[model samples]
Target: MPLNSYQHPCPGGYQIQAADMLIGGTLGARVNWGDPARDVVITAGHLVNNLNAAVFQPGAGVPGENQRIGHVAGRSPLRTYPSSREFLGTRAETPGQRITCRYDFAYIEVAGDSAATSYRIPGINDTDEPLAVRDPIEGEPVHWLGNTTGIVLGGHVRDLSYWMTMELDPTNAANRQYLSVQPLTLIEVQGTMPTRGGDSGAAVVAVNDRHIVGVHCLGGTTRKGRPFTMASRVPASPQALAEGSSSAGFDEVLTWIARTKAWVNS
Candidate 1:
């Protein structure tokens, strides 16, 4: 079957389909445990919450035919922040329902079977070497691994420090209720690395390298009609992850996975 026929976006890996397929909507990220002894995956909370009845395939080719890994029963609360009104306006809203801004991310626990074993990416086993988060040097090659175009799309980071506003709806009464959103980590790319509806939640990794600097979470067209991508830093510092570890959070997600799941075989 054509890859686009599948429900999820693509990055072309045995586990990519397995992990991404279990997520709902077009947004979800692929995560590694940084340990080979145990198996784990991470994604947005909204995606997993909508996946209660979904089955997780471990190693199957294509989007929907992977081996059953597990199901997402509980998830850390996390919300996907869109980059524009057009994107948010496209979503369905209901009355009396509250949207969560915190914990917009979640982690999946996988069994240590052959399928999980085969999903390993070497040199990811060590957590000691802190991942690099250097600014993209001009003319330096970069890449993003996302389900864009129903497959993994890669391109160089064309520009940096790009900024734009998006729409946001607050679920709580405290703080600013509604406002336009802005992000600093905007990126541009060339070639056929077109991002589409389901490409959110991908990792913006350095090309030919294992360093993952940002997460592909949003996209939009510029005033000039050119497409661009946006991301938030993974927060390399321990202190930063601690502060924003709750909603629209990553620190809590990663730390939660570390405590709840046995990613490293003891």
Candidate 2:
């Protein structure tokens, strides 16, 4: 459960949910999903499957049942496969398809009369315009927020292409077990960022201009035991995604955002 919760309107930096699973962040209630352009919210794609389509605020069974704010409208795929080769992990492995690995994002369709939402990240955004956003650069100071650690600051983007091999369930005693070795490209945050299990989809904001650059995915210790955080570059304009470094795999939602540019605030 949330130790602390922000008031309504569903702005960035607060807690959101998918059934009982605590997810976070909503870029804004703006984005064209279909016929009657519905409001759009952003988060990690892995958390947006059909089973957990209904989104609740605070939690599923919190103060009341009216906390549902949206449903899964679209999601970038997070595909994985059986061990192609014993390249990374011991035992068995499910390496992510290179294309889906670097693109971990999803969209939520809010109700027509839902409470207001904003793209602002409190303490980070200054103006009323959408949260300034782009990809993170190496060695740049950064910030991120989530239910686990709200508003972590003074961290740097350590690496832009760090790959990992992770256990399907880390809680198990086996450390060599692995699954979903994803895209080789990832934004690595320097130092232990204080993020925990609940902070998976947190947005990594660049200190300069407070740009929402990367989406927080996973964290771990270096071989020497130093901490580091990994994130995927935020999907940007179609031009940026095609010509820029956002990689492939976000074309479905990104194309919609580009086509409906006026309504989207990403």
Candidate 3:
């Protein structure tokens, strides 16, 4: 929701940066899960995996004051549960074979005067509103604002399935494995506006209303293995392995927040 004109200030799409890196994803949200006093900023897990990366408003490369905001507080594990019980690949044929999956999220506690107790996007629900997580509808339009890409419109929900992403060496050998939010719970979107590397934690909001369907994570290609030519450039994230774009839905994020409540510092 743009205020005044089609261009208005949206607070969530801030910058995420490592020491000398170009930049990572945008800040997804500022939230308090269930506790009001505990303030935290949300973004892709890979962005803050280094733990020492600094977050900047208007991002690092953007031409602005580029104020430092906070540091990474905690991040969910790349794998939240064991993939197998007795033997490896034994459950490959099981109905919910991807049950142990969890990836792509980080909670950053605001430092000093940058702390925001409440956060909201016009098309997304107000922070004061109760959480209402919903599955993305295929073919429905979605929206998001990113620090690098700005406002992206006319994006379509592409897929909702078990997503497994791997980062491989140049030799094509696997280096890392990332899980979906849960068993077959990932939201894939195809937007008319291109998503670059720095847009990774941007909120994927429903075009018609205030429902945050997913958080932007990976950006590279379409589901059919086509390259995204519209993008300016991909982030230098270790997870960026020339793969398809995807996201973790709200269902998985909210659930993880509840299960990991004990880890919250505030």
The candidate that achieves the highest TM-score relative to the unseen native structure:
2
Greater TM-score among 1 and 2 belongs to 2
Model 3 C-alpha lDDT per residue in residues 101-220, reported as the tens digit of each score:
343556666756353323664345545543232446666676666666655533665445433332311232343333444322233345334466667776666677655555676565
Count of clashes, each model:
13, 0, 2
Q: Choose 1 or 2, whichever is better by lDDT.
A: 2
Task: Name the weakest run of 10 consecutive residues (lDDT summed) in model 3.
Answer: 229-238
RMSD of 3: 12.0
What order do candidates take by TM-score, descending? 2, 3, 1
lDDT of 2 by residue, 214-247 (tens): 6666654443444556666655542322332222
lDDT of each: 0.39, 0.52, 0.48
Angstrom error at residue 150, model 3: 2.2
Candidate with the greatest lDDT versus the true structure:
2
List candidate 3 stretches off by more than 4 Å.
Answer: 1-10, 18-22, 35-37, 50-54, 58-65, 79-100, 115-140, 168-193, 223-266
The full ranking of all candidates by lDDT, starting with the best, is: 2, 3, 1
lDDT of 3 at 7: 14
TM-score between model 3 and native = 0.55
TM-score of 2: 0.66
